[model samples]
Target: MISGLGLSTGVAEAEVESRRSGCLWAGTSHSQGAEVIAGGWAFACTADARGVPTWVPGGATSQAGTVPNPGAYTDPQGLFSPGARQPGTSYTDYCVGNQLVEGTNDVYQAVESGGLVFWKAAAPISDWNFDSNSPRPEPTWRSTSNCYRGSLL
Candidate 1:
């Protein structure tokens, strides 16, 4: 039985294997403390409260890390999949180079980059209608868009 992870004989081993999976950074997975640079910023491999590894950007590391392809790291995701969610669904937004998007292809990619158009946190789908209108005007409202209606709650 693992000390911190309390599990019976059968499950303990499998749990341990999953726990050490490491952070997914750049275009690959990395172990804890492994650091890398993406989109011209600094990032360190770390784990979240749930123990899932993820990239947390910090001051550039001592070893000048490599720069990965911007496209691979920042492809927008759910922004196009209307079937995955409905119009009024809540979503997590991410920005790539000043443009806030609904979803991204890679969580790691959206998290970093050295581009002039740095990503700023985009507004959540639920909060688009703040002051009667929206900051991001899309072609249509009542549906999922970068700024669908910007006000529908």
Candidate 2:
């Protein structure tokens, strides 16, 4: 019975669990107030919406006041690179040290395709810290284009 922006009614438990299993943190979008999942030691993105997806440079925070990576970096040479070279279009290279949780450095990117926008995030390294009690999963990338419908929901 989970209800919120981008989530359809009757969402299955398995689906929710799957999303949770892979994400280090999942919550709402900072700018659009849409739900988002991040920090999974891999790249992940949400499905396309009816309208353009809002990119929050400051990243999103949880209800508990916890802020994730907050979109601090940009990849000019990699995928999800913004259009044209411009100020505020690039950021420091994202790495494990930039993550909210230790050993969970992941990058989140939003892109447009087929008249829809999608979010992408990934954590490229594993075992960032040998002493970390909980080792993050292997580096990976994922994207979901159907997770949102637009600013309307």
Locate the minimum summed-lDDT window of 10 residues in model 1. Answer: 78-87
Backbone clashes for every candidate come to: 11, 22
User: For each candidate, what is the lDDT?
Assistant: 0.37, 0.30
lDDT (Cα, tens digit) per residue for candidate 2, span 98-127: 232311243334444553323444333331
Across 35-73, the per-residue lDDT of candidate 1 in tens digits comes to: 555333466767655554555656533343353332222
Superposition-based RMSD of candidate 1 using all C-alpha atoms, in angstroms: 14.4
TM-score of candidate 1 versus the correct structure, residues matched by position: 0.35
Model 2 CA deviation exceeding 4 Å by range: 1-51, 59-106, 119-135, 139-153
Best by lDDT: 1
